[model samples]
Structures are given as C-alpha cells and as structure tokens.
Target: MGVFRFESKYAAPTKEQRERYMRGECEEHMFGNDGEIVLVLYDEAAYLKDDLEGVRILFTGASDKRKVDDEVRRLLEEHGQKEQRPDEFESGKRR
Candidate 1:
C-alpha cells in the first residue's frame, strides 16, 4: 500500500459528508467540498479520519502512487485548494 499527503485550507467535513465518505460513496471528492490537508492511503478497507488540522482517507483498494496522487490533486482542485510546495514550508509561508 502507498500513502499520499496533500495540504489544503478548506474547512473540515460535516457529519453527513464524513458518513458518506466512510461508506465509499464519495468518488469525486472525499469530503465533498470540505476538509483541510488530506492523507490518501491505498488499503483494503475504506476509512475516513477527520480532525481539526486535516483528514485521512483509506481507499478501498490498492492503486499506483501516480493514480492516488492524481486523484488527490483532482479533489483539491475541485475544492479550490492548492497543494503547497516544499519551499513554502521551508519559508514558513504555509497556512
């Protein structure tokens, strides 16, 4: 299994959205239009872990790193959030 991480400034997901995501009903966007930095994992079980700082999602099946990364990027884009570059963190510009 592989794990991919992404950062966002969006709000945390609502109860309903979280429920849907846990059931593997959210294909286009994990937390609908919410959630901050997200961690995507390829695993056998689908799971969602949400908190104040970020969210973590375990996909239902294993997938290539590229595919997982692309899906995360797409989800971020859909929510109008951009992944921060490493330099941003180094410069202390991350939010």
Candidate 2:
C-alpha cells in the first residue's frame, strides 16, 4: 500500500468568507499544497457540499509523487472526472 497522506486543512481563507464566493464576487480565493499538489479551496463548506452532492470534487495530489498522483487520478476516473493538468486551467477543473 502507498503511504497515507496527512490532512492539513487550514481555514486560511476563512476571513474571506463564503458570501463572496457564492455571489461570484470573491476577489480571490486561496490555494495550498500537499507536497507538490496544488489546491484552491474557496470555501470548505462549498467544497465539501459540492463533493457530497455529486456536483463536483476537486482532488489534489502531489504532482511529483507517482503513488499520490496515480491514486488521485484513479479517484478522478472513478468519479467520471477528467484529469486536469497541473499548471493549466481547464474548464471544469477550476471554479
């Protein structure tokens, strides 16, 4: 089995609040990295809400780690989501 990844959820953007996001008025969201993985979580509630509702799921994995990348890619495939390029912004990949 591959090494399990740890959780590092920071309410870093908590101050930004969720109102701006739902209204599409957020000047900017926040991003973070789990190793080489990059993630932009506008609102934790919204993110988890979308994921739980099957609307969308933003998966992040270490770009340079084979096991992590493969695992994340597999999840995307299982969820019927197209794997997004690391540095490129695809239509459904980002908000």
Candidate 3:
C-alpha cells in the first residue's frame, strides 16, 4: 500500500494537480507538513462518505484497472455530483 497525497508548501493541490497524481507522474517524493489529504487507501470513507470526500485521484492496491474503475464509478454515483470525469459514457482510455 502507498500513501497517495497531494503535497505542496504553498496551498492545497488544485483539481488539475490531483489529476497529474492520478496519472502517476507527479509526487516524486514526500515531505512533512503538506496540505490537506484528498485520497487514501485505508481511507476515511467511514466518516466522509467516499462520494462526499475530496477528489479521488488514485486507488492503489493489488486491484487491477477494471476494479479501480468500477470503484470510482460507484463512488461518483453515490456522490450525486458530476465533479469527476467519465461524465457521459466510456472513459475512452482503452481500458
């Protein structure tokens, strides 16, 4: 398991920044006293519903892409918000 955090000394990461992390291109290293925690593995979905929580950038584990994609969809459905992508149909990522 890994701690997927959007860290910055200036301020909390923006939506685009979170997207970059999701692609596994950013977050080269970790530092102390970063900004707010958006996503996590053993996440706080208990209190903060997965739907109501911050932007879900990544879901790391042994789970494959299909499983993660399904989980993300489920969370968004429960959220009732069109914040994340895949707004209409397929994600067009070639799965």
Candidate 4:
C-alpha cells in the first residue's frame, strides 16, 4: 500500500481540484500546525459524501471483460430444466 502524509497548512481545494484528485492525478496536502503532508489514495468521493454514509462513488469503469458465455449457457440450461417441471410455471392459457 502507498503511504501518504498530511499537514494542516494545505488550503481547501475547489471542486475542479477535487475532481482532478479523483483521477489519481492530484495529491492533496492536509496541513497541520506541525507540518504539511500529502494524502495518498485520497478518494474525493468519500469527502463529497460527507455525512451521507453508504454513498457510492462514480468513476471510470474497468475495461477487463469476463468471458461468461459458458456460464450463461449453463445457467440457461439449468433454467430450462427448472422450467420443464410443471410447478415452475403457472398453469394458464398462452398465445
């Protein structure tokens, strides 16, 4: 894990500045009377969601796609088997 420092001298960042920080580009300094330090792995979304717990942070999604064709096929087969049982479906008229 990357370690970051924080100090009290750093000024509050603007909206744009926080956005930049979300992109893993900006390193913010949390200032204190002792000294200034940089915050690593700083998530701006968490800060924005202040007081609102359980909030999700939106950002770029991963590009890695999983090959689920086989899994989907198996699931469909299982679903078909389940549907084959009369209890799985309601006995009603169909078009």
TM per candidate: 0.27, 0.22, 0.25, 0.23
Candidate 3 deviation (Cα RMSD): 15.5
Ten-residue segment with the worst summed lDDT in candidate 3? 42-51
Which one wins by TM-score: 1 or 3?
1
Model 2, position 40, has a per-residue lDDT of 33
Clashing pairs in 1: none
C-alpha positional error of residue 24 in candidate 2 after TM-score superposition, expressed in Å:
31
* Cα deviation of 65, candidate 2, in Å: 2.7
Better of 2 and 3 by TM-score: 3
Clashing pairs in 2: none
Candidate 1 per-residue lDDT over residues 1-95, each given as its tens digit: 43323233344434654454345433332444455434533224333344433544444344533355655566556445433333334655668
Candidate order by decreasing TM-score: 1, 3, 4, 2
List residue ranges in candidate 4 displaced over 4 A: 1-66, 88-95
Q: Report the C-alpha displacement of residue 9, candidate 1, in angstroms.
A: 17
Per-residue accuracy of model 2 over 1-95 as CA lDDT, tens digit each:
11223233332223333343333422223222212223233322223211311232222223322333354445445444433435355577655
Off by over 4 Å in 1: 1-35, 40-56, 60-66, 81-95
What are the lDDT scores of the predictions, listed in order? 0.43, 0.32, 0.36, 0.32
